[model samples]
Target chain A: MKKLMITLLAALVAVVTVSAEVPAGVKGKKLRMALVKEWGTGTHMIMHINGAKSEAAKYGIDLSVIDANHNLAKMAEGIENAVINKMDAILISHGKADALTGAVKKALQAGIPVIVFDNDFAVDEKTANGKLVSMDQYDLMMGLLSQMALVQALDGKGNVIYNRVANVPPTDKRHRIWEGAILPTYTGIKVVNTIDLGTSNPMPKAQTALETLLTTSNNIDAVYAVWDEYAKGFYNAIVASGKKIPLFSVDISDQDLAMMQTHPEVWKASAAVNPSLVGRVQIRLALKALAGERIPRYYSMTPILVKSADLPKERVSMKDLAKLYPAWGSSDAFVEPWMSTLKK
Target chain B: MRQEERRLTTKKLDIFGFFYKYGTILVTIGALLYFSLTLDNFLNFNNVTNIFRSVSIVALIGLAITISLTIDGFDLSVGATAGFAAVIAAKFMVIWGYGVVPAVIAPLLVGVVIGLFNAFLIIKIGIQDMLATLSMMFLLTGISVTFQDGSAIYNFMPIPGGGIAEHTMSKAFLAIGQGKWLGIPIPVYVMLVVALLVHIFLNYTKYGRYLYMIGGNQEAAKLSGIKINRYKLIAYVMSGFLSALAGVVLAARLGSGEVDAGAPYLMDGVAAAFVGFSVLGTGKPNAFGTLLGALLMGILLNGLVMMSFPYYSQDIVKGIVLLLALGLTYYKMKHKG
Candidate 1:
């Protein structure tokens, strides 16, 4: 009897620890979710969409993606439609707060759970009634990590070429960190040149500008790219000039990875958050809210520092990122006990 | 007394004509001299080559706009067509694993097809050139986005559905944009050759005269038995071809195929063409004037950049320069009338 009791207790503990019981209200229920995006064209946005789709599928939730194509009116309409359809949850990405606040408020008033990524909505606990969550890729931390890497690499003293694209929300945040935090602390670092071409295809423009700068001046010691797109151009120019200047940047993608790996000596490091994981977490948070669980008003995904020296010799994609850094591809931030009972 | 007044009037007209004829050239020279005198290394060989190299692509697009102006038609679609060609060429090399010849030639062929379609809309369907090409611009931008699934094509990029794109841009392909001969950038040489050819074609060729005649007076050209529609078709087709060539060079320069990459060139190209109208008092779009216009803008921009001028404010300067050039030409025309 004593041995049997012990075995029974062990079995109970294993079940409690290993598996989550489905909430009685949502058990085997079909849920519908909508992802209204400001734009969904780039590699990062695509991965984010895929992540959301994968997560929604695991729960047998119908996921609809409405790409606004950078039109604010379309994005507002997307939210309004989601509210009219009475979606179980809604996910928003990269939109102007003022244009979306009213629609977000309507969704909240309708009692639909709302999760936003990379956009800050004015609605808070009072407006949302605790059903809204806003999340970002932690642009602040990304900027700090990337700039610190450059500072450390150059021993905090070097003439650097800085690249920036102003007026963008995420980039604005990163620039704040640089201007507010990094530059003041690192006095030894002098910005010799700043480049902002403001063109859609910035690579060629950036390459040409840097090439011109190189001919006129040779005092550049390093390059700091606020976005990896600019870094790619700087990398090309540096290689062409046969210069050994190191590059540090924010953001990562398969193409960025390939470039970093090929010229590890030039592209020293980049700080990034997995966009796919960002999507998955947004869905998870929405589902948790749908399950009547209380969630934070704001959440930020932890960023990872990817160093070229740490990369493997063979070519690798985002899929293989987890093998290099365990925290890269998966996040348990919004995982709920009921999630385990959801269908895969 | 009347004879003396007539002499004064003729002398004044001669002075005005001289200024109208040489105003743009004089301004360009003045800016060049100013930069060379004030800025360090502004007159360096590399810097001069850099200015020419930078404007080369825009100059090619300017030539496209110049051709359309010859037939008194506007092509708002040239920029979009160039962007579409860029994406297509990138697709050919990176997505389909093709060689440089196919990658380059295929987009030029696509441009020709686009031009034919534009001609059909403008000539057969009786739509205005502005409206037709504007619609073509939107359509081509949409098609390019759809073709690439709204993603850039680069070396080792991941495709939309699955798998990695294995083929990288070939060296020969990149060389068209990045290579140099005799210490001159390859694109500069290409631009010079194309400019010379276009200048010759427009000024010296019989077909060129017919096109200009149609532009100057369409009904008169038709009455003179000059196939007006045929010449217009030829003009648009040539416009498309040159725009595609610009796109190809842009792709090579970036070493990637970026969507909407050629859009920014449209305004600059148009500005260059308009500014060309005042060059040597041509009063119409000419290849040599177009090239000069691009060079003038390139010099101003290069000087501003070297001086660490804010990028946002640089456009204001460009607008003022463009306005000045246009103002000179228009003021001359109004006075003449």
Candidate 2:
């Protein structure tokens, strides 16, 4: 009896780290969480942080934000520190999975729930205290749609410029779709320029890069920027050249809306990730993991395709966004009943 | 027999002297010829103009760095200073909704203050110029991040309060970047004007001579009645002035302020300034040489990109160009000494 009890206790301890399930809810319970970001360079990211703050209020969670400013070592160190501090949960946003994997694994080993947003760790969902939350379906859509935007604009045959930074998870996700799903579909499309807009403010650099491309080759039909800022840079150069080439990209900000409205003819369309909702969703996943609720290893977001023609004459707000994204305000549809681990 | 020997030596010396003086120029012409022959559009008027217009910013910034290098100092903060100026100028119009004068002056004054800050640290605090300016680079870059709250400032940026930004680059400011003055880019003219003026000042003026003297031997210049500190101070301030000026033009050209606007130029400026060392075999920093350096890089970049080379390859080529230029200049200088 004693020997059998020892084996069972060992199994229980192992189970506690990886697959322990909570009874019902942890309402009114205060949990301290840390958010580690690769960089705070985008307005959408700022919005996401704000959403995390406001939405996290309901659960009375105290959030600490650490900005790595796109430094890989700093991002890892931030997660390591959070693990040392024994935060109830830690969420890392938009950092390289490989760089932070060891730190995140260590956190999980400590029985601290590690929730990730938009990082491609490719870790097994059954890992201890680890949850890879958020989805890339929307990002894939961004690529497909951006490609579609180019094809439609070019009347199904034209030269295109491809810009995306490899190793950046979200960018890579969209880029993979573009390379795999879209490029093959459009057999006539020729990539005249390829720029790796790696995780900086892409506007200025893209302008210079595109300007060089323009001086060298004037036969480009359209530009497919991985991000909207890159598109803006390309658009700026095109405008300067007095060319009618249109720009298509992903990500939407207030400035994007304004620029599109002002120059609708030049600006085509974009795939908008409700990063604000994604932020709230990230917080919800953190809370779910904290409560021992069943969470998927990979969660996906549905992106809203915002086009210049479909836009209203005035400025856009959250309510206006809700119409475009059904899951904009609530995280109900993403939540599910208890499951030990999610299958790929 | 002695006269014949002397003539042979002089003739041999002239051959080596010819290469040293005109190697980079020869190379520039060689590159132009190669690209012109190989790339169909490389020598097109519009393409050449584009190349010059694009390098105008690099040329202007390179000129500022050249001033510092001439005085035996280096201002690594030139790029960050440009970023700061760009941020504040954009903020003036896009955030605070101010007019053009404030937009322009705010960044310029900020530049002056930065110059003073760097000057005080180096001159008064007795820190080495490289070390002092290097520290200032960090501070200025951090300030730029804070100014925009770690995000880009564009027209109609979402304010924290509730609404969007209303201010934008006015026509006058946009014209500085977009408009042409008699078919030449305003920036090219700006580059030429600054280069010509600085060239005249450096080669023709006594003050400029004093600066070169201090650069050659600071203690010697100080002992010989030249105020070494004042000239060094002026060199830094001039760097600041021109960095800010470059940022203003960059802002005008970009039509919006970018925090990282000047970052790429740091390496490009370094290359251009070093390339200037070999120009005309001056073996010293000069405005005209720096302009040539900028044009060389501009043509190389324009030609390479027109050939549809990958973006990363462009960086490798730039590295090789800088390496070759510096290698040639350094060995030549060492052998001369």
Predicted structure with the largest TM-score when compared to the true one:
1
For model 2, residues A1-344, the per-residue Cα lDDT tens digits are 67436534533443466543332334334678888888766677788788778766755678998989779999999999999998888887877777888998788777677767777665565565345564453677777767787788888788987788777677888889888877788788888778764556567667777877776676888888888778878878878878777888888876677777777777888887777777777777876665555577777777767788876777665445676556554555444332222110
Question: In candidate 2 chain A, what residue range of length 10 has the lowest lDDT sum?
Answer: A335-344
Worst 10 residues of 1 chain B by lDDT: B305-314
The best candidate by lDDT is 1
Residue pairs clashing in model 1 are none
Q: Candidate 2: lDDT of B114?
A: 83
> DockQ of each model against the real complex?
0.45, 0.46
For model 1 the local lDDT of residue B87 reads: 88
**Which regions of candidate 1 are displaced past 4 Å?**
A1-29, B1-19, B159-164
Model 1, A43-75: lDDT tens digits are 778899999999889889899999997788899
- List TM-scores for all candidates, in order: 0.91, 0.90
What 10-residue stretch in candidate 2 chain B is worst by lDDT? B305-314
| CAPRI classification of candidate 1 | acceptable
What lDDT does candidate 2 reach at residue B285?
Answer: 88
